[model samples]
Target: MSIRTNVINLTEFRNARTGPPKRSEPESGLMLGKGLTDQTMIDLIKKFSNPVSERDYRNRALLNLMYLTALRAKEIVSLKFSDLFLAPSGETLISYTKKGGKLAFAVIAEETLFFIREYHSTFEGDHAYFFLSLPRGNQKERSNLSTRGLQLIVNSWNVKTCSNKLIHPHSLRHTAASKLMDLAGSIAVQKLLNHSSPNTSSLFYTKPYFNASKFISWE
Candidate 1:
């Protein structure tokens, strides 16, 4: 039997605020916190997602995919080309074994698809994984990009801009959820974030700073 609690921890926020976490900070200011604010997330997409150079293409695609799908950090790194296909509804979707070996689905955004196609068009070599590490001196190795590597790339986006919040990759997931909650409430957010229950989704939205708006529609 699964036990569930739908309580919000008001005091937990105060406790968390008492001290800086005893750990490494964001490599490039990826922007994690109570949650990244909505406008800041939009600003991030606009600033970094250029898809110009090989590295640009990869980072741009990665950022857009992270925001669009709201997949977990490990799940994002675990994606393969074979996982994506056209759904009967004519929407592009990815099907894969999730945690606990459960089958799952996530819809891809059109902007994400465009960025991915640009990435593929510019990428140097093929790999089993969809995204690869552009290791110096030997780019074609097509090594599986580790979750830490993905974290660095994502955090790097805000390095130049700088932020008060210490950003993490999961910040993208929360940013997506905050936006989704404003647009579709907790149930829709539960679907996007793959929470076991809508209450979990609501809990995330209840975070003090997660006042997001609209949905994933970037121009």
Candidate 2:
């Protein structure tokens, strides 16, 4: 069965027995899970050429921005040109239009800036959307990449890298959260991630327990 089907079945069974559904808390603690490490990210950059061709350059721009901003796939896919701007200090800011049109800013990295410039140079369509799709034949309508497409891209990269790590597109967000927590603390992470509550941020800081090795460190 499909993963979603399995999940729905499991949820139905659990709810039938429990009377009311129970909400699970977000995982807490440092997790040694699969994600794009610094080296892995470098490898991806090398494997995929910049602009990779005109039609895909904007897609690549979105991918890089999502990784840097730690934005959810849906948020990234739905973003438009008007949502982006340059601040007085020369930092590129992305204004998210979700969650009651909340705004958040992330400083643009030099590498990402280069990709964005390259994408803008090659783009030809009049679409206001930052990312556009090319239609095939006369039947299919062009559209931006969906959330599922984003998931598949990450999964494909994970498989290509041949790491046994279970990396998801969301793992980029996790990595950003971890880095923010380490550099600025949980409160800063909460703000940068645009979490509605501190409790949401706390879950990312929780370390997963694995075997007894973590507790039995030799001093």
Candidate 3:
């Protein structure tokens, strides 16, 4: 069994102690903490999840899938065994329903695909939803996992890794957008993320920092 305890929200605590600001100001267009590196994320996942236990195996798969696919918590919990697809071109497709009530798919990493398979093997219950909670304290067994449960899972990992930072499952989405924006243009990241507006990707998701010295020549 994993550690069961309270998690302190350092950000909220600091904000509360500081009290209200002197004046209201316009919010910044850029979202900070959107650049959690892949290594850091994977490290936290590895640290928290033990492959020997079925629960940790499921958590490992969930965390890996969240990082690799950049899916929302609701979308992740809504997934099912049928969502996995082996394309004729040898690509693995992970399908889920988006918040906007649209069908969406993400091309998952090979490692993540393997984790999903492993999770399924160890997962108890013949539930339709891919993720489920082990029967606990008179709660009826269900096919689907709740969004709140997913939030707690992410929160637990966040607390374990960095008690001061406000990283959660949604942070993975932001990180994915930031990383993809650097590698593939914003349009590509936008499409992958299923954002209707390019402005959302540019203004909210992508980090605005860049080194001018690398691209610009000053003689």
Candidate 4:
């Protein structure tokens, strides 16, 4: 015999839990960061290029994937080799856990896939995680890259590029979303970002499409 507990009350309990918001300011509107442009991204990638070490390849691939896939830093760090799949259409399908513990998939571009393949080729043996931490000191344990480590990677790139605004890993996500929203429609960006709320994606990522100046013509 087994006893069953209803979890609906647990939802009510969790919903009552509240604390300070993560950010001091709002995530969208005027508070949002001035995301990187395509040219800036290109320049940053060039700066990261170094043929001597395999780490450079990994860095390039990591940054490119963030920009192309619009994946969160946590999602990227949590990625395992098993989560990646090659579709019959030649697209890379990346499975990741979203904020709500929901499983989501993002399609990787061919260019991004090329870098990922290049990075993967350098690794020997079957690794549990897609990205591993660099060997440090006597620490022989190989583990996945931490979220802080990934942030530091992005910060190092930002400093090297001498970017006016501080660019972090999430900035890459914003860049991808903003750029895609501009080129494609809100629906496209919403789907790529795996946003549960289409309004949030559209209102935040997609800039005002129509020119306000056009509404008022000089007579």
Q: Give the poorly placed runs of model 3, Cα more than 4 Å off.
A: 1-29, 34-39, 48-50, 123-125, 137-142, 159-164, 212-219
Candidate 4 has its poorest 10 consecutive residues by lDDT at: 24-33
lDDT of 2 by residue, 14-90 (tens): 88898785686547763335345667666665666645676567656766776677877777767666667888888
Off by over 4 Å in 2: 1-27, 30-34, 49-51, 55-59, 88-90, 99-113, 137-141, 159-166, 197-199, 206-219
- Which digits, one per residue and each the tens of the lDDT, describe model 4 over residues 45-126? 7877764466788788898789778888899889876777988887778788997898888886777778767776775556
Worst 10 residues of 2 by lDDT: 156-165
Candidate 4 colliding pairs: none
Write out the backbone clash pairs for model 2. 28-206, 28-207, 29-205, 29-206, 29-207, 30-206, 30-207
RMSD of 2: 10.6
| Candidate 1 residue-wise lDDT, 38-139, digit = tens | 677778778765546888888788878887888888888888878889989899898866778788899987888787777777755656676877867854
Candidate 3: give the clashing pairs: none
Best by lDDT: 4
Better of 1 and 3 by TM-score: 1
TM-score (all chains, Cα) for each model: 0.73, 0.64, 0.72, 0.73
Instruction: Give the Cα error of residue 199 in candidate 2, in Å.
Output: 5.3
Error of 4 at 87 (Å): 4.4
Tens digit of per-residue lDDT, candidate 3, span 1-219: 323322346556777999776775323226555557667866877674668776777778887787677888888888887788977788988778898888888887788867767876874446666688766767756556788888887777654222246667787777777777778866877787898877777776555465779989867
